[model samples]
Target: MKKLPLKIVLLFTVLFASSNLFAQDFQGKAYYVSKTTMDMDEWGGRDMSPERKKQMMERMKSFLEKEYVLTFSQVESIYKEDEKLEAPGAGRGFRMGGSMTGGPKYKNVKTKEVIQDQEFFGKQFLIKDELKTIEWKMGTETKLIGQYTAFKATATVPVDRFDWRSMRRSNSDDEKKEKKKADKDSVKSTNTDITKSDDPLSEIEVPKTIDVVAWYTPQIPVNQGPDNYWGLPGLILEVNADRTTILCTKIVLNPSDKETIEQPKKGEVVTQAEYTEIITKKMQEMREMYGGRNRGRRGH
Candidate 1:
């Protein structure tokens, strides 16, 4: 009995080692479609007529839906949006929400590095940041994602303040507080006509964190995924984060033409924190601008 147990252990160890050796030279591509839901009602769209709401939804559809291609190897991968021409004004939603969507992102699992190309308000920024680590709790629940068997894993990740998926419009209590503050500030101002500015971002609130669920396949045996998702024992096939869902539609392993994986080097280099600060300050300025405009209109 003891000898049989020892043999089984050895056999498992050998298989694991062989899989690692095979992964070292593996290259593949995964095609994914990402979609995020926007609740018009939550954003005070209930007051609009049904036809107007429908028109607004149609206009925002293209911005909330996208396709992406993830080309990956043993330790490195690049995820980029699949480019397609859109109708005029189809992408206006991108301006309202800060950049960091559908940009080319490169990740090196071995070095724990992430290099992303981001364009915000006509300025390009190269975000060189450490790969986000998720403490995934593995689950035994298994299902099939196409031909491969996928297993469930879940984690909770801190939400970025700029993450649109998890953002919600401020409630009545928040609005009241803001109004009170504006009233006080108006009293202090030399010009009694001036009130608080109408900040574009004031009504938006993002949670501190959100839960994520992913499905990964060990058959591919590469630690790569679409977007800023990785660190699993296998390649991630699907991810459900906040209001967004990313699903792999097709996969091609070891194609005839293998492209070299390269990091983006075109934008002004900045750390992730620095980029956040820049956007934050810009949002503040927008609030001031809107506030001044509102005051001017009221004066008239």
Candidate 2:
């Protein structure tokens, strides 16, 4: 037989090494310290006016709950090596009259004012995330979390803290106007209004720090987790990604009734099948009471 070329021999050596790489047969819990960022750009466009930013910020705060989920997956070259895995990102959008806002009564919810398109995988989440890179590590240890034997690991993600304030008109516009008139009269009578040194928006409360901690396991290797958190060595167990938290509800390994875990892609921002009722129901009620066709009209 002719001598095998060195290059081909090296290639075979690498292949052999890869084949010999141990198949991980362990599981563990991943934990995260969760947080939330309310950004104007969560709506996709930017350069908003101060008032608009405030309004969107307030809306975002009222809309997004401070909790989310994380997932893990097993690793195999055949499954994860060549696939163009998409890192989970977050984006915001709306139902365009699909929810209560989509109904005939709230047709005037500004057409696209409500953010209905924020996906757990739509934007890269950060909290003081100046490094802009996901720091990761993986290890071996027999640990258990939610019925899975998890390995221990650690990672640090930097992020930016974001919050918002705004004024949204409600059916009580007239009442508010009367209140404002009363306030002005009181201030004029007191004459101290001219000397009052408080900022007009002193009541606005915006947080300034967001730090997150994450843990992941490769046992499930799905490259997914609760909203806007991903790209870990394994399924993240607990995440302190921001102001919100996404905890693993349950974990299963080779169950007698194994079922494919499919994430829903139809709901609006931060909304999964699990959380649809709390938010969607309230939205419907708000539309019925405040924006009813005959109730009243308000301004932004």
Candidate 3:
């Protein structure tokens, strides 16, 4: 038997090692920063004074900017907000009311299961359900985000009924009363195009679908991303949806230290749809309570 050349033997050994490394489970930690822009113009004709609007916008900035950490393996991932110490004497009201995005989200890419630990109005809920299906249209556009070359993908996803945008569009007492009057008068006038509806919620034309734009890198080879985004051929490095952008800032692959990726089992188990219903009912109750208080104050 003839012995192979030394260089060929060395090349074969290196190839074997590389293949083994690729075959092993890939674990990584990705750091993300999310930012959202507030639409101050949305309140342009509202009852708020300009000074009040300015103050509200300033307060909203704090809630819009946040940092998150995502721990992921090839088949499972966990996404959660990076905890930060609150500034001394910082009011919690605005932070609590501004958005419902912060939560511990766990997803299994292989099984298509998602479990989220959500907190709303001092109550905790464990949202367990299948992963949402997004029909993403892959685009040829590519951009470099940090060190990775990411390909762009777009998808149209239905807006959650309890999303911040929908909550913001909820009718105030004055608006509801005006809508009711218009609807009653519309019955008398046979103008089909009057655009008056008995349901105040119907009057608020919230966009039924939200456009999602994501930049993903095939180098990662993980079917995972921030929030509810997944199912792409590559790992999503950046996502733009619903007026907010979440971008991956750093990624550490196959770190020596490994953290457990376990689903949250603490809160009451509920589906995402059920949680939305709970939020809607709670908001209605809150509106009624506030409206009653305002009426009482005027009566005095």
Candidate 4:
């Protein structure tokens, strides 16, 4: 009878070791589909003919819908857009006013660190910043996401936090003047000239705060999600923020091959606020340069 207790002790010891091994090698990959809705009226598209509006919407569709993959471990994760060939007639039209698209984003929950890759005006920038802690309000509701049950959580985040879809037009007088000048220039110039307008971001505005609703699954047992989202008790499966929605379609846990989660080291290292300021100054320089040229043309 005493030997029976010895056997029980040995069995528990084996189980404890196995659990630790699993924790050490634990990893997961999640696939997400992100979509954003743009309001045509907000961007002065209401006056356009139906054919012109259709063509514009078709071109913007590629930017509106995207797919991304998130590879995560217990403490670290990398979220990036999945590469796919551009649709027919979907030229790189969005890059005319400086590329706002960001590359892979790496986050470390344990250290509260974030590193993002950005390309602005043909220059690479590494935006390294401390992750802001999100205050999530957990709800009692639950829903099934694939095979796992997810719980609802909500939070409000400041709009200046690197969201491209949340951009709108500011109501400032300076912005109005810039818009008026651009409109006058476009009437005399080609579409290409209008696309490369000076101070393209002068009228752009982001709201004060954006509401976010996320659905997370505790079964995954990891606090991670797509884009600059982390926190909560489990892996987030879906996120709805402002005009964008990101939903996870597939999850692979502990696959045979593990991906290396490395921080992006390329580009000039700068904080989020510093990077924003840099873009602002660059846009101002472009505006001054173009304005001077226009005045000289009129003087002649």
Candidate of highest lDDT: 1
Candidate 1 vs candidate 4: which has greater TM-score?
A: 1
What TM-score does candidate 2 get on C-alpha atoms?
Answer: 0.32
Candidate 4 residue lDDT tens string, 1-300: 345555345434534554454386699899999999987777888899989878887777777888999999999999998989876668455543336658999999999999999898789999999998899998757788888777789999887734668987675787667678776775566433323245445566778899999998766767898997889877899999999999999999898999999999999999999998998787667777775565555546
- TM-score for candidate 4, please give it: 0.80
lDDT values for all models: 0.83, 0.37, 0.75, 0.81
TM-score of each: 0.86, 0.32, 0.76, 0.80
Candidate 3 Cα lDDT to native: 0.75
How many pairs of residues in model 4 come into backbone collision?
Answer: 0
Q: Pick the candidate with the highest TM-score.
A: 1
Native-to-model Cα distance after best TM-score fit, residue 206 in candidate 4, in Å: 1.1
Inter-residue clash pairs, candidate 4: none
lDDT of 2 at 95: 25
Instruction: State residue 149's C-alpha deviation in candidate 2, in Å.
Output: 3.7
How many clashing residue pairs are found in candidate 3? 0
Which parts of model 4 have CA positions greater than 4 angstroms off?
1-22, 96-98, 171-202, 293-300
What C-alpha lDDT, on a 0 to 100 scale, does residue 68 get in candidate 1? 95
